[model samples]
Target: MNDIENRLKAIDFFCSGGGMSYGMLKAGIDILAGIDIDMSCKDTYEANVKNAQFIHADVFDLREDELERKMNLTKNDNNLVLIGCSPCQFWSIINTDKTKSQKSKSLLIEFSRFVKYFMPGYVVVENVPGVLRCKEESGLSSFISWLTATGYKVHFEVHNVVDYGVPQNRKRFTLIANRVTDINIIPIKQKGEVKKVKDVIGEHNGFPRIEAGHKDKSDFLHTVPRLSDINKKRLKKVSKDGGNRLEFANDPELQLNCFIGKDEAFKDTFGRLWWDKPSPTITTKFFSISNGRFTHPEEDRALSLREGATLQSFPKDYKFIGTNIAAIARMIGNAVPPEYATAIGKAIIKSQKNAI
Candidate 1:
């Protein structure tokens, strides 16, 4: 345990921006340390979670004992929990191309290496739903098999973030394992009514809006991309309150070339989100209207960095440190929403408390 108050110690691998750490901490777990290859996340992760240590390194380079020592673990401490959320870019159906490198596909297997070494009491894994399909042929199936063989009961399924009180329609694969006791991640009963886009990004929040490519000098990250002349004209044509480019597909002059060849080329691009519904999955390029349904319902431009983060369920105060808007967007979009992670943490705590 990290301290007297914590019932268990957790170490997260591929811990970008400390989303998992933050949520587990909220659920009262001791998130002892976090490891990631991206140095960019170091300041943000360290800045947010004071109680945990953050390590900047690839999982392949780390040894089990070194990780254990870094986490202040002893041989006798059986309450170790490991969180592995290896990069899912290669595993994502939408992102992966045939020519894309498969280097990251090995990370799931590498995570299993640590599991075998530490033999932790509890394990949590989060990734894109495509991961489940790949893992069976890749290493994830073998990993689950190993967990069951070694006395860990495992459960995993595709879960929507909105179902867990997040204000977005993002869906992901979540897995929880417990060697200390048999457990299942209880289907989260939503705290209240479904949150809507307006609920998250309504006010404009006193931050003056800027065009695309112009930085919000006053608030470092509350900035939007500068729209191109053509896109500006297109935005004018797009209807408000959940409208998209497809509304004028017949207009040859205004229709995008990419949409010309296909029967249905992602009509959601350059789309305005619905005010009453949960926002669509906020992607790295969400600041650009050319990406999926990112335009502000009433505004003529795409969402700002702050707006994107809000849609992803990051609290207003959750400071992301990065100069480039796209880089910061990547951080927010890739993160497991803190709300979703908190529910997982709560589940772990429940199982632990009920453990024999």
Candidate 2:
């Protein structure tokens, strides 16, 4: 049994697929409400997390009164915490074409509006490392300044997910600010052997071999890609556990466009994951075998949605709502790994105690 007062209450913004909320809940924090623009996330958020209210509203159009009412919260609730992790597609290094979009940059300003209006006791923001390079004139910088001006002690760091026990090499920028605490908070990387890809997948965990377009009934998000005949033959020539295209490309017909180039650096393309190493970062196109180093070590097809979710630290029992692969992949890929979130939650709880 645990004491209720020690549990913090939080509202998550841009809460896609409920990863942060799931972590907070696991750490004993009560998530009061989750707000996101995506309707597909509602069922997943509400179904998996108990007592969390889901609101499908654009942050730009969200009203103070409505949010307060829906959350059963008041402006005077100093114990409340606000978590904002807006979309990072605009600022990601992978999106080199800057002209493609810059709309999500405005979301930080919108998040700041809530902080200014509610004056919550604590605030947390997580996003890509590119966010740190965004100009001070940008909305993100202004939001940071506003939090500082409000007497909050702030801590921010760019960290790899693997440093915090997630079995993937994803990096993120994390910021935690608190109005009530004077303590300096830093996320402590657990001292242990780093987890590997083989430690996470395969039949040992009850995950069976799945081909493309086939959904696992037990794990609905699990969907594997069907392999083409040419790719199958290529994979066959490659070694059993750790083979790549370089091993099978002796046949002229098996060469891909990128493989023919002398200076190409994408060696991981069409590669198999080593069972003992951390998995690569899960991306939106994770369902496609050709997207990145997503091929299964022993299987011929790309990793299923459930495997991606597992790498993202989502529990096997967690249910995603969408029927289409794109929607499901977006939800899983966009999520903050629950393990990382739990670490953040524990830190916040520690800071709150020291504040007294």
Candidate 3:
């Protein structure tokens, strides 16, 4: 039994579908709430994480006093933990769209305000690594300076999630801070062995094999995107293990216009996933082969929603509560993979204990 007496409370900011909270809770933290601007995440977040209340509000709009009240944080001590994994589309290298949201860059500043108010003993943040490479030093530099001024020792690093036992090859920027002591995340080796796409979902037996765009009647979210017959034929042309759209550059009808002259325009698209390797980073449109290297190793259809969720390390029992495939996919892809969060939580608690 845990001898540490005070309630080990936590609040997750930008906690979509309670992914981070789920893992932290597993590490014995009493998660009080999850805050997000997306109202759609409310159902799934509440459904999966029972004790945590889902608050639908932009973080900037949230007053620190109100947030502290919701967390039931009375004494400011080592028992309180704050987690911030802000939305990171703007900081991502893969998304080069000119129309990306400009407002997302400042969410970290708002996170610092809450830290000042609650004076939590511990904090954890996760984001795309590009956040460290921003043009203005004012962005990340200012946040670090404030943390130091506020008396928190900070450690930030980029880590691949696969090392933390997640079955996908996603790299993220992570930061851990604590006023209680100087600390570092205990580096995690891949537990036992690196898990692959096949290990997570190859044995799942609930649904029958249906073509793309068709859902199993009993399982609504176990669905894949519909492929055109021509695209289906095109998929058949590529080898199962390491094929991509580039292979079809020689074929007139099958070739993509962007890749017709060049051998590879967007090679990851229409690419097959190797069964033994970790899956490529899951994106919001993982259901469509056109989105990423999402095609099943030996199957013609793109990854089903269930397969995508499994690759992201969401528990098999965890249920996402939306009907639209796109919205559900966004929730899964945007999440901090729970297994990775679990390692962070364990590290924080261990570090705190060592300090004592």
Q: Model 2 compared with the native: what TM-score?
A: 0.93
**Residue 123, candidate 3: how far off, in angstroms?**
0.7
Candidate 1 per-residue C-alpha lDDT over 221-304 given as tens digits, one digit per residue, 9 for 90 to 100: 678878888888888899998998877677787887778866376888988999989999987888888778999888888898
Error of 2 at 243 (Å): 3.4
* Ranking of models by lDDT: 3, 2, 1
Per-residue accuracy of model 3 over 193-269 as CA lDDT, tens digit each: 88987687653545346677777444436778788998998899888876888777688898877766776467888
Candidate 3 stretches greater than 4 Å from native: 1-4, 135-138, 203-208, 217-220
lDDT of 2 by residue, 240-281 (tens): 566677776567787776667642566666777778889889
Query: Which stretches in model 1 have alpha-carbon errors above 4 Å?
Result: 1-6, 98-101, 204-214, 218-220, 261-263
Off by over 4 Å in 2: 1-6, 97-100, 240-242
Model 2 residue pairs with clashes: 197-277, 198-275, 212-224, 212-225, 212-226
Q: Tell me, what's the RMSD of every candidate?
A: 2.2, 2.3, 2.0
- Cand. 2 Cα-lDDT: 0.81
| Candidates' C-alpha lDDT | 0.81, 0.81, 0.82
- Better-scoring candidate (TM-score), 1 or 3: 3
